[model samples]
Target: MGYIAPESPISDYDRDVVFFEGDLEELDFEVLQKGMELGFILEQRQTKTGDIEWVARDVRKFVAPPEKKVIPIPTSTKSKANPESPVNIYPSSYRTFLEKLSDSLKSIEKINDSGNFEDAVFSLLRLLGIHSVYQYSRDAQAGKADGFFILENLAVMYDCTLRNPFEEYKKDQIENYIHKLSNKSQLTIETRKADGGRGSKTLQIQGKSRQVWIITKGNTRELLVYDSIKVKEVAIKDLITITIEHCRELSYDAEHLSSKLVMLGD
Candidate 1:
């Protein structure tokens, strides 16, 4: 290893020449020997202090690399859900949950849709260890939340309903429900905080959470709304498709399986 720089002021005539100044080690010798074919001329010089220093002159002319073009990323504009979107396929720890979700959805379809739908949803949430309470208290705005659940410090207030044809009226109703829930949740948090700092202790994170609006249908398409706005259309045709798609999204540590060929000689 040695110091490399222009031998002198980089003039037009000597622009290609670069100088290396220092003692050359074994590593330096190996590197110089390998690069000898690259037109790098190596020589030795004695300094005034009686020390030997290596000199390497690069004969190749330097050329700058081409500048890369800047590409701008397109922003999202509430893109419609695509059922044909690619999903990852791999082994996951949540494989059992995916199976159970698939089985539950199928079983619910076989039973009475209107009567058993809410119960089934609640059961599924319970299985996921999400504690739910029905008909929770609303704020002063009379925004009625269908249900409430506590996830760690996140107070999730949700509205569960069965909508047919998925019209604007249903959307408005859900929006109203979310408004009420948000107001109540905020008020509750403030009250808890005022009461000897109990609120801060209970809800470690203090903020309005996104409203979960689960809109189920017997024949029409299924939808999952957040804060009264439609997010996922559940556009897939069957439960297996939905399960696989959702599971793929949920799976972060996906493993890709591959096979390799080997050759042997006698």
Candidate 2:
């Protein structure tokens, strides 16, 4: 696409502050056509900001994907846990562990307050260095998110839980979130690298990943993790030895889960 600047100057942060400055007139038919399918508009439009008044139009567009976007995943990927997978997360020592886990999940964008345990887990993941947002609320004011974390270049949605959990519940919950995330969306797109060596598949391309995080809650519990082209479900449990073992194999920070299930009595 091409453009005719206002002659003043457009900085990189134009989108952040300018609201709308893209000169769609410069956009070629091909680019505009592609942009439209990608959720963009090339026609002229107007808007009013707090104080800055400016006439802007052109190819600048906001791509809002459908509310229910379907996400697909590969088959080779599967949960790695066996009967011998040792777990180290338990209620006895979960408090100290969880306090630390909470500290690590600082990037969580939203937290569900109702019976939805996933929201709480989203917040916890952000503390654990996993970037995530929740999208359960459909209100216009509600932001876009359904417990997604920044994994690689893709935003992965995850079903979250911390209390009253077992492997069966987690497995079902994961599938539910997967269904929710895949309700609607454009075909898979690729995310380009800064170096541009090999472009990776993007959030728009293929399907996004939906993960399950069972916050260690209460005492010992049982769980499972299963994934395939059809559906993905993970069994979850609170047995410390089992959790630690699974963490070792899955490579997730076992220490985090252990800290979360810390119970004073357990």
- Candidate 2, TM-score vs. the true structure? 0.28
Candidate 1 lDDT over 18-51, as tens digits, reads 3543333223443454224333444444569975
Q: Which 10 consecutive positions of candidate 2 have the poorest summed lDDT?
A: 228-237
lDDT of 2 at 29: 48
- Writing each residue's lDDT as its tens digit, candidate 2 over 184-233 gives 45323222233533332324414543333334444333233335212222
How many clashes in candidate 2? 63
Residue 96 displacement (Å), model 1: 11
Residue 117 error, candidate 2, Å: 6.7
Off by over 4 Å in 2: 1-120, 138-146, 153-155, 167-172, 180-210, 216-266
Candidate 2 residue-wise lDDT at 19 = 21
TM-score of each: 0.34, 0.28
